[model samples]
Target: MTTLIETFAALSDPTRLDVIERLMAEGELPAGALVENTQMSAPAMSRHLKVLRHAGLVEQRVAGTSRLYSVRPEALKAIADWTMDHRTFWEAGMARLDAHLALEEGEGE
Candidate 1:
């Protein structure tokens, strides 16, 4: 499995990001289907898929001659877990900022 840093790096590319978003929204898709929606050449799309697979963000299954790809739930869950772990800190900071903004607005009024 790839680390969080690798996952983030893979998703940093717009093409790979689009692929991840599509798989999450549309569920499992074959390689050919993914190519159809993009302006990228088939080879370029394949390379992006390879990067996603290596980063553990997506998994591929062989169905006869075709390769089907889908977002790995565990991978996505890992990201969610990381964010939730930091939730309290950011939430508190945002609340403080919101309060400050409210005070400023009241003073302006």
Candidate 2:
């Protein structure tokens, strides 16, 4: 549970979330590659990566002189499992919202 909270907190930052998304989309990438096309400096990106690594959301590997990063599958699985576990709650809320909207439309008719 604590790890889940940490994961969510790390992803709350836009830059960190973007880093995760990019890493997922493009396989494992070097730290330098992750820094490119971003307005932030390399050091700033490094800090974001550190936070992600600490959260267990990403894993880092050393290849020659570069630091390669990739998303940890287990972390993603945990998120998916948690969401699915609460699927009933979300569906119920949406159903209630739809019923309310339908009633409002009928009143206007």
Candidate 3:
């Protein structure tokens, strides 16, 4: 799994974020396939992949002469876990706001 800081930093870029979203949605793809339909140059895409790989957000596999890329499941799980850790805070805040609104509506009636 990737360190939280590194994972967030890697995802902070729009291109990198899109790359991750694509991989997650489409499953493993050849590195070249990732650049298809994108405006980024091959070299630029390659650099983004390298950054993700270093951050442990992506894994690469050699298939013949091609390199296939995919999102690291553990890295994604780490992110989900981090967000879940804050779920209670947000849920409680929403509950309090809902109650406050309900009280205000009652007083206005």
Candidate 4:
């Protein structure tokens, strides 16, 4: 299982996040395909991919000479689980803020 820190760190980069979103939308794709339509060089993209791979956010498969990349479902699930676990904390904070704002408005009336 991938730690939340690693997963978040890898996704912190915009390029890396885009890569993950693209892979999720388009399914598995060759490294070459990932390089297309981007201003970044293949080497730079490769480095980003390496970070993602190390984070266990993506898996690489070798099809002969090509390297294909795909998002790992479990990695996403882990993130979702973490977020859900903290949902109540956020909801409570929001609720308190709303109540505070209501009190402030009433005070001004």
> Which predicted model would earn the best TM-score?
1
Task: Say which candidate scores most in lDDT.
Answer: 4
For model 2, the run of ten residues with the poorest summed lDDT: 1-10
Candidate with the larger TM-score of 1 and 4: 1
Q: lDDT of each structure?
A: 0.92, 0.91, 0.92, 0.95
Rank by TM-score (best first) = 1, 2, 4, 3
CA lDDT, candidate 1, residue 6? 91
TM-score, one value per model: 0.94, 0.91, 0.86, 0.87
Q: Per-residue lDDT for 1-109 in model 2, tens only?
A: 3378998998999888888999999899998998896999999999999999998999999999999999998888888989999999999999999999999999994
Mind giving the per-residue lDDT tens digits that candidate 3 earns over 45-71?
Answer: 999999999999999999998999999
Query: 2 or 4, which is superior by TM-score?
Result: 2
How large an RMSD does model 3 have?
2.2
Residue 7 lDDT (model 1): 84
Compared with the true structure, model 2 gives a TM-score of: 0.91
- Once fitted onto the true fold, the runs of candidate 2 whose alpha carbons sit more than 4 angstroms away are none
Q: What is the lDDT of candidate 2?
A: 0.91
At residue 78, candidate 1 shows an lDDT of 85
- Per-residue lDDT of 103 in model 1: 97
Q: Candidate 3 versus the native: TM-score?
A: 0.86
Between prediction 3 and prediction 4, which has the larger TM-score?
4
Give the C-alpha miss distance for residue 26 in model 3, angstroms.
Answer: 1.0
- Candidate 2 lDDT score at position 81: 89
